[model samples]
Target: MPLPTGPVIGIMMDNLKKRKSVFPISGRKAVKWSQKLEIPVGGETVLYTGSMYQLLPYMIAAVNRMGKMEDSFLGQYVGLGRFFNKMFNVSSIMFRPKRADHKRFRRIIRDIARLLQQAGVDFGYLYKKELYAGALAFDLGVDETFVAHAQRLSNLFKAQGVRSLITIDPHTTNVLRSVYPTIIDGFDIEVKSYLEVLAENDTLRPINKVEGEITIHDSCVYARYEDVVEQPRQLLRRAGYTVKEPKNNRNLTHCCGGPIESLFPSMAHQIGGKRVQQLKDAQGKGVATMCPICMATLQQAANGDLEIDDIASFLAKAFCPPGANDKSAEEKRSQP
Candidate 1:
């Protein structure tokens, strides 16, 4: 049966950017489906604010954009896209809108309009709902928004038929797993991190040995959010590489300062600098993070100081045992 219209499971997502290096193609879809199935997903501020946090995003884009930032080229390219999107929406509003059929999109856009109004965007409220989740925390890096959103999700579990929530990264996972349960009514929903499920299939192991010394940044989300300290370490070790942990490893792991990016881009740098220093201190050749967002954000923040790899990418490129690379294995992974 189709779900009734009102009060559908809420997913507080970040805004969509044209060329995002931080989020993987799969990350957004993975979370989208999770929300569609009644599992709620949330994020920090959906868009880049004009605060210092803008610097990291700008920096990340410059590093990844190759040559888009030079001599007014960026505004010409990105500006035109934003212009067309609004124009398309306005024209659609003047006539018909595909988004009107999408309750989720409608709701998020409304929220975005409100935030913009509060931030004073003077666009006459282009929406009626909060299209993007607000910042998780007000700077200094915290997961308050995730926890609050999850708790809000907890309020709907009975009717939504949602028993579990899943997060793609450690930052989100940590808040959903630990902090949320301790606050509000406590999201009674079971929150699972994606990698744990991905690890369920033994055949899903690495394909080739990732040679060289490697270290895992037990994201605050994975380590503190869900006590996922040992699993990633074990996975990395099994993939035939020595795993070195920073002194402040596990639950005590420091924030990569991603949440602070919006308020203090430089502070985000300071935090990221500390994290990279830890990896360097360990003398590891590369760093692995479970969240694509983390991998991208930290890589940008590190400014090429250390190599950052997502766990999946790390596993995909590394050696796998015999038969693990077979067709049957791939088929099984897509079963759900």
Candidate 2:
């Protein structure tokens, strides 16, 4: 039997519709990673996280619980959970992500910020004002909800005086750049992925040369939708890491099975496993993923067989100065 997708999607959509996030994470929690960096609140060209990385750990935890129930006798009871979710936030009670997982994802976001700073990019964060880009709702075809959310986000950006956006993840970059303008009138915000920003800055050279070949997992949204295929590669090459291409790469990049994980956990796992194997076939020292979903999904599938990390983690190690990894040290260094 197929998983009960209707109730599952309903739970997620309800969370997004009510909480402004696909998962019910507080805005404070969403922006916690940037606190230590002392990024100013809002600017013309802001670093818009879209809360993708912050929400992934919770999303993954929820999917893991759901996967156990999928296609089994327990799966039928998910509708009951949806019923309670409407009354209260059931996801908060049902899915508690591991502390270590939360820390890892938080570090990835910090690394991204560090990379941007090292590149001499002057950007501010929206902090608690930051909102999820409604990628899941947009992807799942909840048109009404997505449209409303998009309008709200557009209003937030305009009110904050945001002109251009430096997005961290592929989904946010694609939706904010390509989809938002199509749906919302007068949506003129310029969106570019941080990779593109870093790649274009010639002054941001790697201080420590990293010697190893890493396979690149191109995000479908970034590759086909946003033409972000070359930016990450250029940055990686400049960071002194030899880029390896997976069999299905660039425009033909394979899905990490993450987009559908909320609905079909087992199937998504199978797809992730296949993609991991494809990366292994590339025979690189490790795998680098530009998408948060890709990193989470592929890491789960790899199961310690392969080393999988976000592309920013690699760049941060090479480009960021010593003590950049320590929050206190970085805070002191950024103090001017």
Give each prediction's root-mean-square deviation over alpha carbons. 15.3, 4.4
TM-score of 1: 0.51
lDDT of each residue in 41-148, candidate 1, tens digit only: 222212211111212223243223322232334423443433554333311122221221222222222222222222322221111111112224312233544444
lDDT of 2 by residue, 1-336 (tens): 657778888998898888888898987778778867988889899998899999988988898888888767988998999999989998999999876666777888999998888788999998988899998899999999999999999999999999999999999988999999999999989899999899889999989868899899999889988888888899888889999999999999999999888888889999999999999999999899999999889988988788888899888878998664643444223211
Candidate 2 root-mean-square deviation in Å: 4.4
lDDT of every predicted structure (CA atoms): 0.43, 0.88
**Alpha-carbon lDDT of model 2:** 0.88
**Model 2 misplaced stretches (Cα beyond 4 Å):** 326-336
Name the top lDDT candidate. Answer: 2
Clashes of 2: 0
